[model samples]
Target chain A: MEDTVEQPKAHGPHGYSARKDDHVKRLRRIEGQIRGLQRMVEQDEYCIDILTQVSASTKALQSFALSLLEEHLRHCVADAVEHGGPEADDKVAEATAAIARLLRS
Target chain B: MEDTVEQPKAHGPHGYSARKDDHVKRLRRIEGQIRGLQRMVEQDEYCIDILTQVSASTKALQSFALSLLEEHLRHCVADAVEHGGPEADDKVAEATAAIARLLRS
Candidate 1:
């Protein structure tokens, strides 16, 4: 089991450092907000107030997803298009499917 | 604008360190996996093969969420239950709503 524990891997060269860092930072903030929400509930805050926080947290997550999607389009999709082949088509289709999933969410 | 950049906050004592660390680690792995999936598509891999990787990436995300949900129930919900009040009920309700959102996703 100890041997199975994987080391943290670095992002590839093509990885967008600025956007990825922003996403991780935002997520950590969201994680803290979630913990705060739990505390509010455990302290017996008003139901409406708790629900409001839930909405905020959900919106934060959605915002993160949108930012990530935009970054993907600008970087990954653009690269595929420049290459210009079946790969480009595949990249577009994959991105479309991802957007569809986000919409459903 | 630079002054507005918030410093990274530390998790509270109530935060489950082991589980949170595991979750973050898993998510980083998923991030890498997502990048890989994009590359696969951009390289013009077979449609079916790209789809398979997409399925795997999605499953990894689901696994991360499930782990997070379990940790929340064990720590946050259990804490609320121990307190025993309207807060406990709110906590449970919040958790239920979260689970519903996850199911929809």
Candidate 2:
């Protein structure tokens, strides 16, 4: 809803921007997890150790994905309907499919 | 690979940053598409017309998801395995499941 040019933005319907500082911070944490894995490899750490890091990274990524998806539905879909048309129906379907995929994961 | 604080960054292992200007530009385009959908509705466009835009938006979002998934595999998974632990297996399974979900959508 608020746009600042400097923020990291995820584009969604209606020129909507997902520019959240916390999102970026979470991504940075995920990035750190990845780096830690890299170091573990170089040190020849145990397999289980690496696996744990991987698990953490995956969950982190999923969490971020869910957040973005939530915003998409709330803002994009809602706006589309207010402006109503076939677009609304299409957005609903598209969002539903996306959610289905997330749940499947 | 490059580190620019101002650039849009997707952090993965080792503080690796997906700071691609092109990616951000593409996101901006997607945002614009959404806004266009908004206008179409305000004008009371046909259902089919709106549906067409929705389809386009879905495709665009899917494409973006695909790219991110690809990156996750190349960087995070690879690093996880090299570290070799239970973590490695977990990461592989996680990545596989994520891919399956994407395909389902």
10 residues in a row with least lDDT, candidate 2 chain A = A10-19
Candidates' RMSD to native: 14.0, 13.1
The true-versus-predicted C-alpha distance at residue A7 of model 2, in Å, is: 45
lDDT of 1 by residue, B1-105 (tens): 111235222223333433445544665665565556455534434433444554555555555556556666777788889899999999888888867765654
Question: Which stretches of model 2 miss by more than 4 angstroms?
Answer: A1-105, B4-16
**TM-score, each model?**
0.46, 0.44
TM-score of 1: 0.46
